[model samples]
Target: MKAILYLPLCMVLMSLNLAGQYAIDAAGSYVKNGAYSAAYSVGEVSTLTVRGVHSTYVSTSGVIQPDPLSITGTKNPGIATIRIYPNPVNDFLRLETDRTDLIQYVIYSMQGSFLAQGTVRGMSVQLDYLTPGMYLIKFSLVDFHESQSFLISKL
Candidate 1:
């Protein structure tokens, strides 16, 4: 009957719509056992390369599907971990560190210009009055360095 045929067609269309909004699990997407375990949503006309923990995965959505490459012996050796919160920061940026011996932090513009530099203690720093732009924040200890790039939008 017409009703039975339409039901299957309608279900197929609904499934396609849901697939477009799929979100991959962030924690489970980590590299597993020296293999590429993450699923990235890439564009049909662009190429993407994900590099992490001494390994690299390259993919071209509409082209060739290649295996991820493993680069051994490039693991991060420093313990000076840095975390930034309120990612899409508005007026303030908070920083936390696992190492208490942090000596200082340096904020830089995307073009490598020094924006601000200062000492921090107790694992937190508040940044204010920053214009809308992208920045590279570097957390430093005696011989360890971890840099993260972030964006700030004032709206």
Candidate 2:
């Protein structure tokens, strides 16, 4: 008799738990059409906005447009795209970019103390002197009009 009474209660509790797993709760607004969608959320702590073009095909290719807004507090129209490689680097870090102008770089500790600064010579920077750890490197054009920073690991 007790088993029969507990069976229905157990099933009810199990159903409520299972239903919560599929619950969809969204706090922000999302608009979707055929190929483009935009979402934005405003909260007391922070705000986020996203806009993108959807790719329909299975190949998964879409035109990536450059973000016109500059987040570096610079007046430049856009930030230059730079590539750094051989991360978790052993000795040297290489920088590659299409810009012909000189670029200045500064290496700083994770605690925000300046460690090193120099121009990219031969498209590479000798990081062997840095101790094994994580560092932040900021790269800015010679004009100082635009800059970007990346986190890198040294090993």
Q: Work out the TM-score per prediction.
A: 0.41, 0.50
lDDT (tens digit, per residue) of candidate 2 on 1-155: 99999999999988883533121223446566544566544333432344458633322122223323334453544567789998989899988887867999999999999999999989899999999999999999996488889999999
**Cα lDDT of all candidates, in order?**
0.62, 0.76
Candidate number with greatest TM-score:
2
List model 1 lDDT by residue over 1-155, tens digit each: 99999999999988884534332322222334554544444345545789989899985553223446667756655655567777666656677666666467778887889888877655555566667767776666755554544454432
Lowest-scoring 10 consecutive residues by lDDT in candidate 1?
21-30
Per candidate, the number of residue pairs that clash is 0, 0
Worst 10 residues of 2 by lDDT: 58-67
Leading candidate by lDDT:
2
Q: On a 0 to 100 scale, what is the lDDT of residue 120 in model 2?
A: 91
Candidate 1: segments with Cα more than 4 A from true spot: 1-78, 143-155
Q: Which stretches of candidate 2 lie over 4 Å from their true place?
A: 1-78
Model 2: lDDT to the true structure: 0.76
